[model samples]
Target: MTDAIKIDVWSDIACPWCYIGKKNLEKGLAEVASDEDAPLVEVTYHSYELSPDTPVDFEGDEGDYLVQHKGISREQALEMADRVTDVAREAGLDYHFDILKHTNTVKAHELVHFAKEMGMQDAMKERLLSAHFVEGRHVGRVDDLVELAVEVGLDADATRDALVSEKYVEAVRADEDQARAYGINGVPFFVIDGKYGISGAQPPAAFSQIARQVWAEHKEEAAAV
Candidate 1:
């Protein structure tokens, strides 16, 4: 096992629970920050589109999309959205369900891969989620993605060129294929040490406990080696 515990997170910008899971993971890390023997953790965010077929400029709102895709009623969709917003607030995330522009996340995922290449993956992911869920920004468009990347200190022209040329499209597809191999049909899935899989938006205390358990096993393995 590696010295630092490797965490590969599969999430999408359009996924509300994914953002919550990201925050919970950080909170868990904070809870274990003072542990002298805790293994250092390194996270890599992988792409997983919640709605791959969503068009670049979807004409409907999130409620409509949910009704069509998930076969839920409009009222049910709205209720789910409200519940998600309330849950997000408890995790310190402001979710604007009414204004969120529902659209394809392929371009946003590509931008995440581009940001990963530039060592700004975390910033880019956060910016994209904030733009999608909180600010109602169009995450599927090149111009908006470039603007978000620039806001996160990435070079604007380079980002635009990368998007224009579709530099990281293959990387996004590869992540999706890997998720398939793992039989993962959800976003915000966490793969710890490339072995343990944790699904859904678990609580911070759960993540903290898992981290300690993983760290203990890691130490034992290192000693045996």
Candidate 2:
């Protein structure tokens, strides 16, 4: 609604920077008036698969997959991972990429859409990212996804049923289509009020500044009308 600035983010559960971006967004929200002002902001997570072609049960390590899919040498992939790991640390995230089991996150994306239907999308999205990146849990499998949903206070049985029927797959696809239409080719992309586009895992201050600016503009336009 125009009463609140809506932040729509397209991200993948398996992306390290996506989790960091989420945290930074939270920091930004908190920076504006003691976290109470967060109610003025409405955030929605959208689906964007970084590696859609990845098999559900990928048989290799993250470095290997990066080398093959990213067209980078094994050493370069490791270096990149290490560099990101350091960045993640700066965000107060203890990311252990070496133990991370990377796989296709399509099913996980569907699970997030299901949570959105149930009004638990935020919790589900955070839990899924933490499960994969920090806890090293499997996200591509239905059973695992259900477990994560249950942890987020969603009904396990209902989640399992929805997943089995592939109920929210279309929602996930719609998100991907919208992302492409926006010419967004990266994860952790944030759209504020459907007008301002902020790409990548920008600093918390950037998010805070955007939120304040958007809220002011929204107010100004409303006042003018």
Candidate 3:
């Protein structure tokens, strides 16, 4: 039996490149899945907020906030987003940049933690990212996020109650703490097999190459035993 390769991904829902990174990683996995010697990959998404103090209903444009926080010119921010959008399109993802609603994602992360208990973490992660990036859904609200959880096969009522009660806040916080301990300063950071760390939104080919290398190393180690 092949051992499973664990992948820990740190990202935020509001992050545009994180969505692209997810698509890139999926493509990489699809490529590896067809190979006979590929090790099984088990992915777990962690929470990392780009703007934890962002209001639930932030007023004005997201670009304005970027300008205020990062002190980058509006043109620079737009250009950066445009570049990421191009990358996303190449990865076969449709990004609705105009409709994206920026807000605090702490509750959304909590919902993902709750979904982990139900064995729907991947589905929940995709849904949350899509809801924030493409669907213009407000992920900061407990009721809205509960509906998203229902779509991902979680119990909606229980999720709603948990969100309102802030049940998994600590779990989300723990992930943040872990990210800090690992010196992760950006989103879309990938930790392969808990040993190798790959940062940024790397291409699918890059991920596939790493997976193949890791699988080979595992095989050699096992054969020597």
Candidate 4:
């Protein structure tokens, strides 16, 4: 049997580019799914908070947060959001930045770790991103996080308990530590087989080409062994 390709992703739920990159990467992986020779690909998501200092209940909208965070004018922040919204639309994502709740994502990250234990990590990640970007829901609170977890087929009470007790705080911190060790300063970063690192939201073709190349190299190395 051919070995699977490991794709480790570091991203935050509040990141717009991370969602775009995820969709594009999925599209890229789909491009080679029908090829019998293609090796399996396994994706593991890690925690990376773009704005760890952001408050759980920010007093303003995304533009307001951006203005303070990026030190840009309100006009410039809105323009940036508009540009990202357009790009997100092209990726089949409907991003409603106007209604987005710009909140700290540490709790959301912990929820993802809980889902990982339940074998629903990817679903939780998707839900959190959509909740934050598309649905404009609050993800920084335990109540909201628990609801999102339940939506992904996780136990509600258990989810609540986990969040309240901070069951996955260490796990989240560990992922962050690993991210720092890797010198990763950005989200939507892809580490392929723990060797090749692809930064930012790349084109779908880029993901397809790299996956195929990695699988081919893995096959060659196996044969040589």
User: After best superposition, candidate 3 residue 48: deviation in angstroms?
Assistant: 0.9
Give each model's whole-structure lDDT.
0.91, 0.89, 0.87, 0.93
**Predicted candidate 4 versus true structure: per-residue lDDT over 1-225, tens digit per residue:** 668999999999999999999999999999989788866999999999999999899999878999999999999999999999999999999999999998889899999898988999889999999998999999999998988898889999999999999989999999999999999999899999999999999989999999999999989988988
Better of 1 and 4 by TM-score: 4
List candidate 2 stretches off by more than 4 Å. Answer: 35-39
TM per candidate: 0.97, 0.95, 0.95, 0.98
In model 4, the worst 10-residue window by lDDT is: 31-40
Residue 29 error, candidate 3, Å: 1.0
Q: Give the TM-score of candidate 3.
A: 0.95
Clashing pairs in 2: none
Cα lDDT tens digits for candidate 2, 96-144? 7877888889889999998998899999998998888788899989888
Q: In terms of TM-score, which candidate is stronger, 2 or 4?
A: 4
Better of 2 and 4 by lDDT: 4
Top candidate on TM-score is: 4
Taking the tens digit of each residue's C-alpha lDDT, what string does model 3 give over 58-142?
8857577678778999998778778877888897877776777778899999888888988989999999988887777888887
- C-alpha displacement of 65 in model 4, angstroms? 0.5
lDDT, candidate 3, equals 0.87
Give the local distance difference test score of model 4.
0.93
Off by over 4 Å in 3: none
